[model samples]
Target: MTHRRRPNDRLRTLLKEADWTQEALARAVNTLGAEIGCPLRYDRTAVAHWLSGTRPRHPVPQLAAEALSRRIGRPVTPEAAGFPVPWREPAGEDPVTGFAALCRSDAETGSRLVLQQRPYRVADARAPSPPALPEIPAQRPAADRDPASPGPPQAGAGGPELAALHDAARFFAASIDTHGGRHARSALSTYLADDVTPLLTAPRPSPSRREMLGAAARLAFLLGRMYEDGQLHGLAQRYYTYAHRLASEGGDRATWSLVIRAMSAQAQRLGHLSSALQMGDAAARAAQGLAPSQQSYVQAQFAVILAQTGERRGALSALATAERAAEHAACGQGGSPFDTYPRAALLFQTSQVLEALGDLPGAIGALRRSAAERAEADVRGRTLTHARFGQMLLRTGRLDEACAAWRRFLSGRERLRSGDAERALREMRRALRPYRNRRCAAELLALSVPLTEHS
Candidate 1:
């Protein structure tokens, strides 16, 4: 005899609360599925089957949950939607161990942690306060230590080992900037899991341990960017959370602030405006008493967050504060990526604020200056900047000039494998579609189509 399936009461309840018909829910789910490149043709019958306790395959459950979440204006996890639990950051685990496990899982081909996309929860934006640092023991002589114990040598603790880790982090960071994360992510993941995690978990003197932790935090932050470049946002968020823990434990308040601000920026990009504002505020608070450059960086991002939330006056106020802080900030500190706040970045933030506040002309001007000031080494930044500049130019009816800007973007885009770059190509195609009658628009549209299709 066959066992009968129970109806998904939880999903039915959610459907009722959302006041959506079966067809509407199915349409929403299908739309989301397409957005993630997992095309679906679910119709009302599919929704009806789901309500009758028929579960779908991998990612369909997630897409359905996200569709419901968007409709209800809150997070709805797969489990809440009467499906199996999706991969999430292991709750209540030690951050270092959890980070290690996450890296290991991601390194494995086709692991769920890397394959599944978890819906962004607005509530998770207000992360828990940093854990208190573990007490450190007195330094012991090398002769007294166990040969089997895992750790760096005392003689080379803060010297060679730390420098080597710093150098590795810089190389990975630069590689990501120049080629996008696709080219270097696998090797980076292997290095983090096989090398950095051991140094983090091993017993060491406080100073050296803290330095190692700081370096690990930066590397984790880079890993998050790599995941983000691949459009695995949930994985990226988990990495960012781990990075924050590492920075906090290491007493690196500046890096902690930077990571938090990066989270804010991610939230903003994903349309979680309220969550973005909250995270931005936390980043500003965390930046207190840090270097002027760090403060300016935090404040500039906070201003964009405020503007996006429609707080015009507050956005301008925060921008002013950021400007004042920048006056005292020295450029090119030649330290960690978080150590310096360059004029180019500030101007880019300024453009974001201005565009959000309905000053398109001002935004365009700031964006041009930003593109000019940006370092030549930042290929990804240059590509994205040019794409954005072209979009703005198109918005202002400068068709020929916009085409020129987008041509520059395409030149750099060939060297990268970035989700943002892909999205820019799609956006260019869409924007130029209406003007296909014009010679310039037709040329650029033709140029963008192949790229968008390949992506």
Candidate 2:
């Protein structure tokens, strides 16, 4: 027997506040769905059903929340609209199996799984880590392979697969750096679900199994980065958690540290200071006994967290430790991209610390150095740097220079597919609104309007 449903007063209240008809809300959701490549034919009837407590599928609730958010000029979460949060990681699931499911979901739905999900709150982050996985198990039968698994293992088991994964990781990393995370993200997810999952379950020697786990962890980390770039922080956090597990199982503490550091950064970006500090401290601890460059990378992130929390002395100490480590790190080392910590990244972290400490000029100086040191091929990084630099200049009353920096950001953003860049464009518009009459602001606004029309 079916149970009776209660009316969704939360959604009704939001609709009343926005003064939007059911048809208008449905149309908005449909429009957003189409933009994200998930076309829909939702109408007033479907919306009425939602109001009557008939929950829609995978992304409709999310789409509805986002549509409302845009109209209301603030965040409208799924929970705010009386809908359960979409695509949450299941409780106490096996890490490997859960990760496979996540990959398949991402591959099948593209960005639909993440496009409307908000960053998880700090309270949600307190859940215990997944328990340590048992040793790699023997291969299952061909008939036992899941949808995400390949039919069977290829002829060359260990070395070849690992090498290919490494190559794919590097290629995707470079692609993300140059073109931004939206570039080939679907393809990458598909590769992980369809190609990589098989090797993960394939029978192998102990050493070979560990190596495969490490390689897979790196790919997962890259996928997490892509999600993070899209500003899908909750989805990114899931990926990072899985990657950390993979690294830990593979006996790869360095990769584990990197993943943890990534989590800390995500928390910091979301303004969860205590959680960020906790994760930052953990990441630094994990980085112990790692190489100088890797240690420096972890330390620098910790320094940013410290500065944000008013721990000036601790921040300075951490920064100095990072500096010494970087000075000792040899450039041009051949290893995983995660293994190398470039000067540009360190300087960017330095800029963040200074900005947190309320030193605008010092932050600007550090950011300029970062921009200068950035590799020419790193278009996404350079664009983001310029965007940050523009914001910094704007804060210092340097309107002309801010506009100049933003011009550079727009120039590079043309080739990028980053959500961060998109947000930066919106921020620029807001910052320049007060100075719209100024020649620099007007000229820049005119230039940027066409670029962000559909954003």
Candidate 3:
């Protein structure tokens, strides 16, 4: 059979421009991948495959472009590598079916082979995002929902109401903070399949339809959060995308902005700072007409991106705006049942910005305040705060104080399932490496064994 697809002419041209052979290019790509901690062991054979139009998965394509760009002394993109840009999925498609299918597959197969690469956090220049969804639907009159339905809604008369579905989601959300996502992910997934998905398609009177949409929208967001907590970033991204569309369908502008902002958060996790910044800016704009609480949340998120990008002035400005919005929002609705951004949340965010800006003392002060008043249910959040505080202390040569903070974090065994917790433990060991022979270091290392096991 004749090979008919276009050869990677662009890649070939770039290789010639850089004065390199296929083997040379493969070595460069693998070298760059290792530097970034991605183990892309592409050989000359792999390069031959790509040149024949076989697409490489994510960061490899990205890594290849970077390698060529550096070699040629010019910017190179995945498109320039004769590869489709990494992860150019149509963004505006209805994500429910895809999202639900993924949830079920993960739950059943126990193997997430479909998510071969983590979703890209930021948009690329090649393919455009899907056409934007229209304005949020107008809120219609809603029946007072019954918030106590323990089971899936019944089909007809006197059936469990939409409010119960919403409430059940809320119950799971409440447990997530204290118990960690791994602790509750199975139950949340089951709820999504059994309780939430059914009501989403269940026939409802037009009057009660608004409430159902709202409940489903919230459930999608909560599921996304749970996925994030469990470090399943790709799945979280999908759920957030679906939730945003659902919010638009229901005219839930408040949550629509939050969901968009959530995608930004996931992008930040993936270290796509610029992409996260773009998402945050868009979310802040979309949230302008929303409640102060919503504005507060987005502003803090924008600050995080700014901080990561080294925009100190911009970050501080956004942080102040977030504080003002948080105050105003506190005077109003106080919190969303779907997510929270209390004072402690703001303080923790401030520490991150300050830390990024190299104000270690200022970061420590903010973290101390955050830890002092963190909410009880925010177990993972508090654990992170403790870990950060400890890391900072250890970095500053205050070993004993750092040990205290690590102890505080380790005490929360329930939160150990999170990747963040594991990183914190690693940081502690690395920090204590110099004093490895010290009694305190040995004690600290011993206490962290259980953490390593869980992590």
Candidate 4:
């Protein structure tokens, strides 16, 4: 037989068993909030709500459980508080339940399930709120000690180890973007399994150690995204799994969102509309209660994923919401990496969704906006946007416009690494295939020569 318990009773039982007074619980919650840059203000009434069967918002429940667990010197989970198990989905469940289930699924299976499902409805993709974006403190020392620090330290010296890990992660991420995962998958995976995982599982975990783990997780996630981009789903899934575990240990929601975004992207690419939508929904839910910048990031990604799943209208709506949230985040008084929500990135994402939806005019408009916002130093981003725009123009039978776009794109390719520039060129050639040997096509082909020579 199944057991049913009231939310209040659960809270009371946990408090009694742990011997914590309401005041004590409130203090712990507030303290943790402060550490994570959340500035939470819980009182007896909040605890009363728990007893009265009201579920706290996203992140709060997890926060309370973690805080209580630390106080009692044991691990506590959300399940203990009378809510449904996190990330589990029942067969034939609602969109929310299905989305949760996708998150709970192991990375490999989850990715495959997402890829196999195809085309989600926009109505089913709505999220209760935006994703979590942590408010990183202005001072490095203060930020490091903030309860919001996601993971523990590596087994060795904390500060240096984390710095090394972050540097390494950034290096690998750059390599993946330049060379593609197919060329470096084995080496990347070995780094995760051999070098990174050991540090994560080592004894005597410290704050620095956790930070290293988080860095490693991000690297693994980038590898996964690279693999996904290269159309290697199987390899991508493995990397995502490692990344997710590391993120969990580090307790970095941003890292976790990164992994989920990669997984969702793979699903969308493979035509698993329902599954992709489900993953996007979960990501949106997970990000709720985060800083405005963080919310903007998640919402923007959600918009892209929804568009990939064929939810054109829903996708547009999501894009609008993302823009508004980002504006709010930019205006808010706080310091964080979250504040680096690139306007170019948002416009680029909007262009992608519009292109997928076959809205050429809309896509072109977004791309123009993206190009305008892109800094000259961001050569790679500019090249990518130009290539995409050129292809879109080619598709819509605007030969002259397409040629102009390709020429402009090629001009920027000189500053980029050879591999990406070549890839962009190849894509441009493919888009120009139908008009091969034609005047416009030949002119475009001539422009490609100089770019190739420079590479």
Candidate 5:
């Protein structure tokens, strides 16, 4: 059921920037696709289709972007390479690009609600069930850059000299948590490609080399996070793979384990249950004898993946271990959340796992803890947590309480930029469709109306 995708101006702009003819671009896409074992025998006619709004399938767009990125000597995402999801951005530096791009969508939804002036239909026992979350595409790990290629800027970085890189990554990461990833992700990606990559390849003393490696790993991890926050799953997976390789080579086992755990979470999120379990197991094994907090963090990831894989007994057992370890780490122990992951992140993962296991009340309890554990710097995350909780409550028939949770979500206007939040709101509205006449449902709709219309 592939809908015809609309043509976009983005590709034309990219072609001008790359100085490539349509035929050449199409050839490049075919070549890249062949390299990845996905033979797309596209030609100029294919390119014409693309230009005429015929959006190609998933990895084809990614391959085309990579082909262009290689030609331009800069990272070119699918959006940049002329394949954005038909959400045309309003012109010029509009910070709220996501909202603007979907303004017409909002308008259409409003019009579809034809009873604006009349009493709307209320809840019906057989009203359509809320749609299940869509299956997110599993991200494929990309090959690392060829060592011979001198990225964009001259590739000469020292070890200790990279402390600034680490600091900058940390700062931007914090900024992303506070301001959302829309604008900041590109900034960080540019910095990584232009400044850090070269420095990473430069000569350095042993100690400085180790320092540089650590910084590189951290920056790469944050880069992955930025991509993930932006919903660029393929790019995020590649960046995470780079970070994992860096950590492994640098003997940063702690970081390596953390990366593995993070990979597991991403895999699970994208519905690769078996791969998630394997990655989680690797993380748990790698963290053996590490600080209780770090081990606790790894085990927590293990529990979630285990539950996802239907290993109920093992999941619960792992969770218990994580609990005890977390408590021990909290008692002035060696487990710093900064060095590993936040102790409360486990709780958030746990809530999802519990929900998967059909423990409704238990999931709510974990969600509450997860909300409380979010750092103040994590503005968007807190909002997401509340929104998810509200959705869960709505599903479980707690309309008033769900509204209360959604109110908290609606309050975080500035920090809520990820389109995931928007989609979650859409789902919430769908759930409310049946109960439209209820006071709480009406209130929820009123609150969200402005978000879509004016975000």
Candidate 6:
């Protein structure tokens, strides 16, 4: 005779079926929290609550679904686990609270004690899905130009203090480009909180405040990108949030688009496919009236997120649309914030999408084009593209090519401290595992040892 399963028994059954340990579950939950911009560090006790039939708050249920799905090797909806459904409020209705609340709730519940007690699976983090979009458009052409330019600097020339802030921001951005995200994230964040934040929040703000606000927004966005690249998603989310708010205050559509892009990245990383899609859609709409290049770029980024979610068809469609927009902008057929949308950047994005979709040959071809078009002076772009190419080559079993690519990538990144490059090295080591005894593999391994040490 069989007995009915108790509430906790259901939890145990789920864990057993998923084959995850409590610590593993906790780690997955923490990762999910980070993806949504709500940094959470949970212990085992939090997992206990869910098994007892106590519902986690709003966003937690969705996160739990994501965490659970990874372990089960199937999609797990919130309803499957007896949780409330996810909701998306219309845009322009309390934008800050609507977005922030969703992220916060998801983070809290995903990291709750009840769920963390269950066993977790690391493979869940890398589950195959759609590819992410690669086109990020400049929101405002004027903002994109040097602030010191003659045609009425977006923010007036009178405020020496504002000028100084712009200089400082440029200095930080240059450091990030020269070094890697790992080298720059902490310092950038410190500067924002310690130096930039005070200036923005100073008493008796000026009417020309939009310029200062825009500057802060850009700084925050870059900092968030660096953090995200460094795998510090939780911290990145906070910075994105701060930037988004600043953008709203400035009423700058371009900055707003940047915020959406940052949010989309977070959603995709966290396994929130629907939320990620929604963010991209929102961004596209917000950028619709902008110049063709800007619109195309935004659309491309949307495509990247879609690809990451395993929406290959949608990703391709979006890519095509972005290309057309870019062409139109280049021909001066329509207004574009910038006259030229780096065609090479679009190619690089396509390569990334192809790589994610397991089209190794296609990825390789695209990468080749991207490499050819990329200028040597664009060190950051070159380092990133080469690292990606190396990773894809290793995945496709082109061990020699992978090694060579890594060598080039490492040489370019050597002058800079790069977390992404370090990750590429680790990936190369893992890929070389199958051929450990081969001479080429041995050579690659020897080269990676120092990379690991530095990382």
Q: Pick the candidate with the highest TM-score.
A: 1
lDDT of 5 by residue, 1-455 (tens): 14476676788788888999989999987765433324477888877777777787666666677677767767677787667533221334221222222222223544212211111001100111111212221331223221211111113434245647656866876776787655466566556656666665566655455546556666777766665665555545655665666665455566666777777777777555766787888888777755667788889989988887888999998999888878877764421223445655778878977987889899999998888889887887787888888888877888899888888877864455764566567777777878889987888887788776543
Residue lDDT tens for model 4, 234-266: 435545655665666556676666566556665
Q: Compute each candidate's TM-score over C-alphas.
A: 0.88, 0.78, 0.74, 0.59, 0.65, 0.66
Query: Of the candidates numbered 1 and 2, which has the greater TM-score value?
Result: 1
lDDT of 3 by residue, 370-437 (tens): 99989988888899889888888877888888888878887874454565566667777778778878
lDDT of 2 by residue, 83-127 (tens): 876354467876677778878878877654553353343443422
lDDT of 1 at 411: 95
Q: Each prediction's Cα RMSD? A: 5.8, 8.8, 6.6, 18.5, 16.2, 9.6
lDDT of 1 by residue, 1-455 (tens): 12235898989999998999999999988766544445578899988888888887667777788888878988888889887744644688887788888877777877844343554444566644643433334666545532212133245567877877877877888887799876688898888888889888888888788778878888899988887777667667778888988888777666777889999998898787887888899888867766677789999999999999999999999899899888877653555566667788899899999999999999999999988987877888888889999999999999999999999999999999887788788888888889999998888877766787665
**Candidate 4 TM-score over all chains jointly:** 0.59
**Candidate numbers, best TM-score first, in rank order:** 1, 2, 3, 6, 5, 4
Clash totals in order: 0, 0, 1, 22, 8, 35
lDDT tens per residue, model 6, 83-146: 6444532345343344333333323634423222222222322211212222222643645542
Error of 5 at 173 (Å): 2.8
lDDT values, one for every candidate:
0.79, 0.79, 0.68, 0.62, 0.64, 0.62
Off by over 4 Å in 3: 1-93, 110-113, 116-160, 205-207, 331-336, 414-416
Q: For model 2, which pairs clash?
A: none
Off by over 4 Å in 1: 1-4, 27-43, 66-77, 85-89, 112-116, 130-157
lDDT of 5 at 153: 17
